[model samples]
Target: MGGPSGASGTAAAPERRSGLNRVSQQRAEAEERQRIAEGRHSDPFAYLGGPHGPSRRVRIYHPEAAAVAFSEGTEVPRVAGTDFFEAPLPEALEAPYQVCWRDAGGAWHTAYDPYAFPPVLSEFDLHLYAEGRHWHAQRFLGAHCTTVDGVAGVVFSVWAPNAERVSVVGDFNRWDGRRHPMRLRLEAGVWELFIPGVEPGALYKFELRGAGGCGPLLKTDPCGRRYQHRPETAAVVEPPEAYPWGDDAWMERRRREGSAWQQAPWSIYEVHLGSWQRDVGGGFLDYRTLAHELVDYVQRTGFTHIELLPITEHPLDDSWGYQATGYFAPTSRFGEPDAFRYFVDYCHRHGIGVILDWVPAHFPRDAWALARFDGTPLYEHADPRQGEHRDWGTLIFNFGRNEVRSFLLSSALYWLEAYHLDGLRVDAVASMLYLNYSREDGDWVPNIHGGNENLEAIAFLREVNTVTHGEQPGTCIIAEESTSWPQVTRPTYLGGLGFTMKWNMGWMHDTLTYLGEDPVHRRYHHDQLTFGLLYAFTENFVLPFSHDEVVHGKGSLLDRMPGDDWQRLANLRLLYAYQFTYPGKKLLFMGCEIGQRSEWDADATVDWAALSDPRHAGVQRLVSDLNALYRGVPALHRYDFAEAGFAWVDCHDAEQSVLSYLRRGDAGEQALVVLNFTPVPRHGHRLGVPAPGRWTERMNTDSAYYGGSDLGNAGGVLAEPVPWSGYPYSVTLTLPPLAGLVLVGEGA
Candidate 1:
C-alpha cells in the first residue's frame, strides 16, 4: 500500500477531496435545513411540496418521525442529519390524500396533506382591501373553516404587509412556526394558509418576523371573534354567526319606519356591564343572564335603549374595555361571543335598541397587541410624536394608512351588520380629530398643511359615516365629541361629520359645576344654567350625564352637590327633571338614579343595598316616572333640534336663582318648565303661558312621592288675565325650593 513517497498518504487524496466537497455542499444546505428547523421560512409551500423535474416531489417536516410514507404507494426517503423526509414521484399527486408517519415508538399515524389545498382568499378581495373599501374585511382575514380540494381545514390569514414572514403557530404543531409558514399574497400584503385537521376550539397565534432587524412578534388576531379567558393570550378558533337571531320582526320594523329613530324618544341608560349588579358570588354576570336581567330592568325603567360601555376584548380589567386589544371579539370575561349575540338579540326582541361604545382613537401598546405590530410600527406611525398617546400610554392609529383605515371601518360595520346593533356611540371623537389633542408645544406633529386638524382622520370619519348610513338606513352614529366641532350631526354632502347626534358636553360641564356650588352662591352662576339654551339646537344634541361625570375622583352625581343630605337629594331630583324636559335626547349613568355615593369603580358592583334607604329609592322611582312621562308627552322629545320647539320665558332672574322656559311640539302641544335653585319656595311666582285656560301640574321634583317636601301647588293652576313676563296670560303658582316643575296646558 506504500507509495514511492514512503506512504505519505497521497494515494487516498482523491477520496479526501471528494469528502471535503460533500461537506461544503451540506454546509450550504444548512440554511435550507435550519429554516425547516426554526419555522421562519418565507415560502414554505413552494419548497415543501412542488413539481420536481416534471414529476411531483414532497417534503414532510417531522423531527420526531422515524419513517414517512404517502398513501399513493410512494415511500419518502429520510434526509440524513435533518428532519426532512423527501421523495420524487413518478406522477402528479391527487390532493386530499393522507401521509403516514412512523414515529420512534414504531406506531403509524395518518393525517391529511396540508399542502393539498388552494388559496383561501380571492384576488378581488385583495384589490378592495388595498383601497380601504372592504367593509367586510373581517370575513376574509380572520381564521375561518373551509374545504379546499375536498380537504376540510381551517384557513388562517392576517394583514402583515411589513412582515418578512408570518406563521400560524399553536398547540396542534407544538407551537412551531416553521411547521406552517403562510403563503404571502403580495398585492394586499396578507398572508394565508390552510391546514387540515385543525378544528374549532383550537388555540392559535401568529408568529411574525419583521421586515427589518428585530425580534419576532406574537399577536392575537385583531378580527378574532373569540378568545381564551384573560391571562391567556391565545385566540380561540370559532365559526362566526352561529347564533340563530330572533329579531326579524324588529329589523322589519326598522325598515318600515326608516326615520323613526330621528324623531323617537331616546332615553339611553348607560351601564358598565361589569359593575352593574354582579352575580351573588361577586363574579361577572354572563351575557345571557344579563340579557334577561338588564332587558327586564330597561323595559320596566322605561329606557328606550341600553348603551353599554366598551365590551371589546381587553387585557386589563381596570381599563373597562377602553384599551381594547380585540376589536371584533366580545370579551370572554362575561361569556362566549354567541352569548353577546344573544344579548343583542334579546334587546331587539323586547323593543330596546343596543348601542355599543366604540373606541377607535387609540389602543393600548401591550407587547402582544397591535403596537409595533410587525416590529416596525406597522399599525402605528414610526415617529413617537405622531403615534404615541403620552397621556394614556397608548398608540394612536395611523389613519393615513389605507389598510389601517379599512381595518377600523370594517369593525364599525361588522357590529351593525353582525350583532344587529342599532347605533355606535363613538368615544373620544375629539381625540381623533385633533393632532395636538392633550399635547403641549413641540410634543406633537402637525398635519400636511401644518395645522392641528388631523386631515386623514377627518377623511376616515367621513368615509365611515357615509358607508354605515348608506348600508344601514335606520342605524344611528352618535359621537362623543367633547369639543364644539362644527356640524357634527350634519350630512357629509354639506361638508359635515354626518353624525346622528353629538353629546352636549358644555351643558354637562356648566350645569354640574353650577349644581356643585352652594345655593347662596348659586345666584352668581345663574348664567351657567341658562347658557346651554343659547345654542341648544346648534347640532342634534344628547344631554348626557354619562359615566365620565362619576369617576376618577370627580365624585358621584349626588356627591357633586354642595349641600346637606336632604338638599343634595333634592338638587339631584331637580337636575333630573330639567334634563328630561330639556330639548334634546337624554342619557343617564347607572348609579346616578340610585344615588351611589362613591366614585365609580370598575371592579366593584353597584351598591344595591342603598335602595333600602327611602331617599335612594325615591330617586329611582323619579327616574322611572321621568322616562315614562318623556315618552308619553310629545312636547318633550318632538322637534328636539329645532328652534321653534323651545322659548325662554325668563332668562334674567339671577337675583332669585330661578329660570323658566316654554317648550312647544307639533300638533300645538306645549309645556312650561320652571326651576328654583335656592332652598326657598316662592309663593305666587308668575310665569307666562302661550294660550292657557287650565294648566295641569305634570311633574314636580318636590313631590312627596320623590322624597321631597310636599310644597304648595294643588294639582293645577289657572292663568290670570294679568300681563306678566311679556305674555297676555300668566300662571301664578308656588315654586318649590331646589326643585323643577313641568306643567302642561289642559286647554290652550
Candidate 2:
C-alpha cells in the first residue's frame, strides 16, 4: 500500500509545480504588454522591437493591425487579449528587420521597428547641452533628418529633465504615444529616438509623463523650425537644406566693412509685414511676393535698412509676434522658412539691410508651449514674482538657468546665421533689465545688492551681444531700451551691455511732447528740443519713431501735430527733417512716411491710398529726399554718434520758436539745419553758420515740391562776415513757416 501511493504522489507534485510556473510567466508577460500599451514603460528599448530574454524574441505593438509578420514572411502571433506581437528572431534577419503589418481593413504596410535603433545624440552633445553651453543646441534637439546604419529617417530629440517617460507622437503613429517611446540620455536629461521613413513635413509633438505623476503633457518641440498656422499647434519637421544664396557680394562687403554702418547713413523703414500691405482679399502676402514688392518700395523710398516687426511664429495675430511660441520658426502665416530666407536675400542683393525685431523678454503661456515645460518650472522661474509678466499675461524666461540662456542665445544666433540677417532690434529691453518692471514693491524680487536691476538678464544680454557680434561680425545688435541704462551700447569687456546701439526713447518722448504743443505755447517748452543735445552722444543711438508711437490711442505721428491740417502736415515735415538732421541714426515706421491719419493697425494695411493726397505724397517725397540727402551729404551722417560732429548754432531762439544746428564732417564739410516752428514766416531771419562761403539749399521742406508755400533761401545764400548766435558768419534768409531747411556749404 505505501509503494503504490509514492509513484502517484510524485507525478502529481511535479505537474502542480509546472502549472504554477506557467501561470506566473503568463501574468508577467501580460503586465509588460499593459505597460507598453499604456505608454508608461520608461525604457521601451529594453522590452520591445529588439531581441530580449534568453529566447531573443522580437516584440511589436500594433493595436490597429489585424496581423503582423517579419519582412521575410515570418508570421508573428499576438499574445491573447493584448496588442503585443512576438516571434523568435530569425537567424537570417538583423535587428532592424522590417515589420510588415495588415491593418484591420487588411491593407498591408511595412516599416523598420523604431526601437531597434540606438540613441542618436552624441555624448559630447549631451554634455554641452547639460552645461547650457551649446550655442547650436537646435541642430540636435529638434527633429532632424539623418541616416542611421545607412537607413534614412528623422531623429527627434528634446530636453525634458522632469519627465519620467516621453513618447514621440505624430500622424505616423496615429497620434498614439505608446507606438514610439524615446530613450532618455541621463546625462543631459534629453529624450531621443530615430524613426525610419519619417521624412520632412511630418507633424509631431512629445507626449510626456511627469516624475511626480503630474502629467501626460503634450508639448510641441521647443526648437521647432516651423509650425502649423494658428489654431493648430503641431510642430513640423523641416530638415536643414542648403539655400542657394546669391548674396556673396553683400555678405563679403558686410564682413569687410565692420563698424562702417555706424557712420553710414541709416534711414531704417520699420514695417509690420502683416499690415504693411495685403492681397486683394486683405490676407497676408507670402514671403516670396513680399520680397519683390517690399524690396522695390524700400529701394524707391531710399531707406537703407528695413526693420521688420517680429516674424517669429505666434498663435495670435494681434500680438504682432511679440507673444512668441516658436523662436526658431518663421511664422507660417507668411509661407515656409526658405521663402523668408529669400526675402532677406533679395533685400541684401538690393543694398538694403534687414533687421528683425527679436523678443526674448517673455513668452505667452500657451499650454502646448514652453510654459511649465516638463511639468515643472523648467524654462521659466518657479516663483510667480520672477517668472510672470502681469502686464503681458506671459511668463518670463528663467535667465538664471544655463539651459534657458542657451535656448535664447541659440535663437538669436539662429536668425542671424540661418537667414543672414543684418541685425536684431531687441524688443522690450527695459522690461528685461529691471526686476521691478511693471510690478509693485512686494510683487518683485530685488538683486543681491538690493538693486532693481535683473542681474541675470543683464549677464544674459551681455553674453548674447558678445556672442552675436563675435560670431556674426558687422551685424548690429540694437536694444529697444527706454530707460537711462548706463552703457547699454558700450563694450562688454569695458563693463557695459555691449549693444551696437540703443533706441533714443528720451529724445522721441521729448520731441513728440514738444511738437504736440500749440505753436504759440511751444516757446515755453523749448527745452524739450534742446535738452536732448546735452546727452545725445552719451551712447550710440537710433532715433526711432517706432510702432509704439502710433498705437494705444496715441494716434499717428501726424495726428500728434497740434495744428490745422495745413499746419499739421508742415509740422510733420519739420519732425522728419529734425530726426534726419539730429545727431543719431534714424528709424521711421511704415505709415508715418505717407502721413497716415489713423493709428497703426496690425489687422489693417497701411493707408497706401492716402498717397493720392498731395500733402501725403509730399511727405513721402520729403522722406525720400531726406534719405538721399542723409546718404549723399557727409556732414549729416559722418558724425551721427560723435560729439565732435554736432554743434548748436542757435538753440536759444525760443522767442522766434526757431532752432538752428550745424552738422560737421571729417574734412570740414559742414551743413546748417534750421527749423522754424511757428506758422508765421520770418522774411529776414539771420541763422549763424560756421563757414562764410555760399550755402546751397539742399532740401527745403517748405518748397512747392513738398506741398509747402515754397518760401526759402533763393537757391544759394552768402554768409556775411558778422558774428551772430556765437558763430563767425551769419546768413540773413527768409525762414519758411513751420518748416525745416538743410543748406550745405559750397567749399572749405
Candidate 3:
C-alpha cells in the first residue's frame, strides 16, 4: 500500500503543477485589477449598468422605524352591517400598497399584489360583495376573463346597478350559484371575483338574484351571429383554427394569369346566388348547385369577375345578408363552410374571380351571438352616442379598440385566405367612415375639433387595408360607399383608405335618371352618361347594376326604360353596351343581362322565362360575345385612365345627341365607340376617327344578335379622311337611334 501511494504521489506531481498555474493566474488577475485602479484605467460608469451589469436600480424612497402590516395569510377583519363593501389597501402616508385578505377559516383567500386601479373602468357599472353576503343572489351583466401565468382564471366583473347580488353559474361549478361566489374587491359599487375554473367553451351565465327573484340568464358575445339557446345565453364557441389551404398553386396560377380585378378593364357580374337559380318548388339552392350553374353562367356571360352579396350568416330569412352575425362562419343555411370554399374554388378554376360582399359598418340586434356580448357593449361602442346606428336600427362597432380591429381584420383575411376569394366589395363604407354619415348633428358624435368626420373609423379602415393588402398583395378591396369621400382607392399611407375600386353611384343614378326620360328629353341628359369621366380618376370605380337598383319598389332596368317592349329592349341593349364601353369596370345584377322585367323580390325566383324568348336569348348571346370581345381586345382592357386608352371624339349637342370616343392601346390597338342618343336612325353619319385610314364595326347594339335592327357595318373596312372633319380621319356610316357601336380600327 505504501509503494502504491508513492507511485500515486509521483503521478499527482503534474496535476499539482496545473493547480499552481491556475492559482498564479488568479493572483496575476488580482494584481492587474489593482494596477488598473492605481492607474485610473477603470471607468466609473463601467459597473453602473451595462449588458454585463445590473440593468436597473432598486431604491427605497422612504423608510419607517416600525409599522404593523397584515401578512399574506392574515384574516381580514369582517365589518358588520355591510353586505357589499370594499377593503382598503394597507398603506401609510399615501404610499402605494398591496392588500392581503383571508376568510375566517385558514386559507390563501384573496390577495392584490401591487394594485393600481385603472381609470377606463370609471364609466362602467360594477359592484363587489363581501365573502359572507348572498353572492348567489348577485346578478352579473357581463364578465370578461383572461389567463395569467399557467392558471386559468377570470377577473369577473358585471354591470347591475339595481341588483343586490350577482354570481356566475356555469358548467365548471356544476351550475351551483352559491358555492363559487364572486368576491367583492376594493372598488365601490362593483362586484368582482377571481375565479380559476372558467375556460374556453365553458357554458356560463350570471344568475341575477335581484330585489325580486332571479333574473333571466344573460349571455355575452353581442357580435355573434349564431347562438345556441336564448338571446341572453351566449354560446361558448371553440375557436376554429384557420382552414388548411389547398389552393396556393391555384392562387399563384391566377396571379400569373393576370386578373381583370387587377386590370382596369374589370367587368363584374353582381349576383345573388340564392336567387340566381332555384329548384322547381322554390327551395334553397345548394352551394354546389350554385357553384356549377352560377360559375359557368358568369364565365359564359363574359364577366371577368362575380361579386356576390353577403354570404355571412344572418337571422332573417329574406335578408340580403347585410345583417351578419357569424363573422367567422359562413352561412350554415347554404352548406358547411367548405361549400363556400368550393364555390370560390369553382370561380377561380373557371377563370373567373370571386368577390365577397363584406358588411362591417353595423350589426343587427337580432343576433344574440353579437348583441350585448359579454353582457355589455363589448364589441360595439360603450357610449350610445358613438355606438348606435339609427338609420338601420343597428349597433355600430367601436373601431378604435385593438381587439375589435383585429377581429374585423381577421374576418376579412379569413375570406381571402380560406375561401380563396379574389376580392371584397365593402358594403356601407360611408357609414363606417363618418360619424354623421347618415345622421343629423344631434344624433352623432363630434370629433376632437367638433367636426363630424369619424377619424377613428377612418383610421381603422386604413388599418384594415394595410392588414389585408399587406397579407395578400393581389386581393382587391372594393368600396360600396355612396359619399364623395375622395382618394378612397388611394394608398392608406397617403392619408387615404386603400380600396382597389369604388361603386360608381353617381353614374348609376345619372344614367338611370336619364334613361327614364323620353328619347326627346334624353338629349338633355346625354351629358350625364359622359360626365362621370370628369371625376373618374378620384377613385377607380365599378359601374354596378346592383340589387339596390332593382329592389325596394325600384323597378327593374327594363321597366325603368321609356318605351314599348321593343323600344325598351333596345334602350336596355344600348344601356348595357354603353356601360360595357364606359371608362371603368362593369357589374350587372343577376338576370339583368337577359332583361329580367320585374324588380328583385327575395321571396320569388328570378324571371328565367324571360330568357326563353328569342330576343332575350339574343341579349344573352350579345353578352357572351361582349365578354369574348373584352377578353380578346387588349385595348378594351388596358390602362383605362391613360391617354393611350381613352380619347373623346365628340360630345357637343344636347339635341340629336351623338358622342364618339376611342379606346386606344399600344401599337395602334384601338376601339372607336359611337353612341347615338336620338330615337331616329341616321344614315351615313360622319363619325370622327383618329387615324385617317379604314375602320370596321367590331360590336354593334343594332346587330340582330342583341335584338337590334341589323343596321350594322358587316365587318367591312371603310375608307376614312372624309371632307370637313376635325379628326385626322372620319367615316360616314348609318347609326341606329338609341344604339351604341364599337368600331375596331383595321388590324388593331
Candidate 4:
C-alpha cells in the first residue's frame, strides 16, 4: 500500500507542473495577441520612435493613427483626424516616428520614441445627480480627481450620467477635442485614462460631447492649491531631486528643543512673495532672491512662522491665485517648481515653520485647460445651476467621488512630503462647506430646509484633515472659515472636520471696527474686544491681518486709525500690543509690521521704506519687543487652550476708556495687560491685578524705541488687596492715553 501511494503522488506532481507551464504559455500568448489588437497604443512604453537617448516613458493617446512629419517650427499637414504631430523634446526629431497613434476620432497624433510627449487633458465639465437615473429631475454635482494612475497624478474623472459622450481637451492636443476622447469605464459611471507620460506641468481638461457639440469649459481642479495657465502655462517640470539640505539637522535640533510645530507659540507673518518685494525692472523676484531677502526679513521680524499665500500657478497676471489652472505645477512666474522647494527648504533651515495658504474651494473658468475637459463636465458639475460659482465666476468641484477625494488628499500629502511644509491654511472654508453659501435661493440646492452645507465637501475636508494630520504628525491644518461652524478645530474622528486652528474672524472684524471708531464710540464697543473670550474654548484661534482686510477700498490698518498721524501711530502701537497679548496665536500682514501706509495691491511692492519714519519706527519697535516679551512670558505661550490662560481683571472703566486683563499660568508666571483708549494721559490711575507687589513695565507702546513719548512709569507699585474684588492685588498706576502697557511682576 505504501509503494502504491508514493507512485501515485510522484505521478500527480508531474502532471500538476505540466499543467502550470501550459497555463503560463497560454497567458503569455493571450497578452501578446491583446497588445497587437490594441495596436501598441495601450502600452505607451513600447515602440519608441525617437533617436537613441535616455529611455524614458511616453504617453501616446492613439497608437493606431499615422504621422505627418514637418520641418522645425513649421506646422504639419492636416490629415483627416490629425490634430498635430510633434515630439516632447526638440532633439527627438533626429529619428522621428518613434511613437504614433490615431486618437478616438481617428485623428493622427504622433510623438518621439522613448521620450514621447506627455498627453494633455483639458476642458472638463461635470454633472452631478441626487440619484443616478434622472436627468432633468436631478441636482447638479461637482467633480474633482480623487486619485491618479493608482499612485496619484491629478486623477481626472467626473460623473455625468446624462451626457452621451465625453472627451478631455487642452494643451495636450492643442485643444483639439476630437483627438483625445475619454473612454467610459466601469459600472460606477467613471471615465478614465492612463496616460503615463503626463507629469506635473502639463495643462489639460475634459471635453463633454452630449446632445450638442460641447458644453462650456470647466476648471477641473477648482480647489487646486497650485495651478498655471495652458499652452502658455508653466512647463510640465520633471524636477531633478537634488538639494544639500541643512534642514534635516535643523528639524532634528528643533525636535530636541521641543520645537515641533505643535510646541511652539505660533506667530505667523503672512506674505505674498510676488508683491512682497518685486524686482524694480517690472518682473517677479526669483525664489532664491526671495529666500535670501524675504526669509531674512521674516526672521528679523521676530515671527515664529511664515504663512505664504498660494504659490500655485494661475492664468491672469494679477489674480491673487484664486483662479487656478495647473493644479500640480507651481507658478513659473516665481521660478521653477524646484526653486519653490528650495525656498521652503530655506525656511526650515532657519528654524522657522512654513504654512501654505491652500484654496480648494472653486476653480477659474479657462477654456484652454481643465474646463469642459473630456468634452464634458468631467471635472466639474454638468448642470450649470450647481457646477458654476456665480460670485467668483469659477467652476465648483464635485467632491463625492472616491477618485476625486483621493486626488485632493494626495495634494495635501504632496506639499507636506515633498516641500516639508509645516502646515496648511485652507482658504474659503466657508464657501467649500456650503452648496448655496453665496448663491441665491433659486440658484442653489439645499441639503435640508434652510441648510446648504455641501455634504460631499464636508466629507472631503474631514478626509483631508484625517489624512494630513494622520500622515504628518505635528503638522497643523488651519481653516479660514468665517461661519460659526461648530468645533472647526476639533479632531475629524470626533464628528468634526479636524483643523488645528481657525482664523478668529469675529475677533478681526470686531477689533478692526472698534479701532476705526472714535475714542468716544470705542467705550461702547469694548465688548467687541472682550466678547471673543465667550467662544475661545471652541477652537484654537489666530488673530490675522491677512490680505483680505487690506485689499480694495478697505485701506491699510494705519489708515483705519481714528486720529491724526501721531494718534494713529499710537493707536496702531496699542493695537499691536493687544494682538500679541491676546489669548491666541497671531498673524500679521507683510507690510503691517513696518506700518505700510497704503492698502495692499497685488501689482505693487510693499513700502519697505516706511520703516525710516519715527512714527512707523515705533510700530516696528513695538513689534520686535512684543516678540521678545511673548517669548519670555511662559504664560503667554503655554497651553493656550486652557481657560486658566486668560482672565478679565477689569472692564468697568468705560468713561476713562481703560481695560485690563491678565494672562497667567499655573506656575506663578503672569503678564498684566493694560490699555488706555483715551487721547490724553491719565496720571495715578487705579488698575486691578490678580497678584500685585511691585509691577515693572516690561513693554510700553509709548516707549522711545517705538517712536512714542516716555510718559510711562518705569516702575509701578501695587499695594492694596481687596477681598471684595476677585483679584488678589491692585495698583495705582499712570496710564498714557492711546497707549497699551504690558507689566510683569517681580520674581514670584
For all candidates in order, the CA lDDT equals 0.87, 0.92, 0.65, 0.67
Write model 3 residue lDDT over 413-490, tens digit each, in one string: 777876788888988998887888777768877999898888878887776777777677778888998888888988
True lDDT of residue 714, candidate 3: 70
Candidate 3 runs further than 4 Å off: 1-246, 254-261, 723-725
Rank candidates, lDDT, best first: 2, 1, 4, 3
RMSD of each: 4.0, 2.3, 18.7, 12.4
When 2 and 3 are scored with lDDT, the better candidate is 2
Of candidates 3 and 2, the better by TM-score:
2
Q: What 10-residue stretch in candidate 4 is worst by lDDT? A: 132-141
Worst 10 residues of 2 by lDDT: 47-56
Ranking by TM-score: 2, 1, 4, 3
Worst 10 residues of 1 by lDDT: 49-58
lDDT of 2 by residue, 1-748 (tens): 7888998998899799999999998887778788878878777887787877778799899888889998999999987777889999787888777999998888999999887777889999888777768888899998999999878999999998889889999998888998888998888889999999999999999999877866789999999999998889999999776889999999999989998888899989999999999999989999999999999999999999999999999999989999999999999999999999999999999899999999999999998999988989999999999999998899999999888988999999999999999999999999999999989989998999999999999999999999999999999999999999899999999999999999999999999999999999999999999999988998999999999999999999999998889999999999999999999999999999999999999999999899999989999999999999999999999999999889988889999899999999988899999999999899888877878889999989999899999998889799999988788889988889999999999752
Stretches off by above 4 angstroms in model 4 are 1-231, 234-244, 250-263, 448-450, 716-724
Q: Write the per-residue lDDT of candidate 4 for residues 1-748, one digit (tens) a residue.
A: 8999999999899889999999996676455434423322222223322332474222233333444433344333332333323334345344323344444586754443322223222222222222221221101122223223233333344444334444444565575544444444334454444333445556665545443534533334333334443336423324234656668875556445532444357889898887888777967898888988877877777888888888767777566776766555567778776788888888888777889888777777777555565455656788776688887888877677554564456567777766778888998999888887887768887765567888889988887887777677677889999989998988877888888889999999988998999997887877887788898767888888888999889899999998888888889999998888887888998889888899998888888788778777668767977887887777776756668888877867777778888887657878888999878899988766767477778888877778887788866666578532476667777888788898887652
For model 3, what is the C-alpha lDDT against the true structure?
0.65
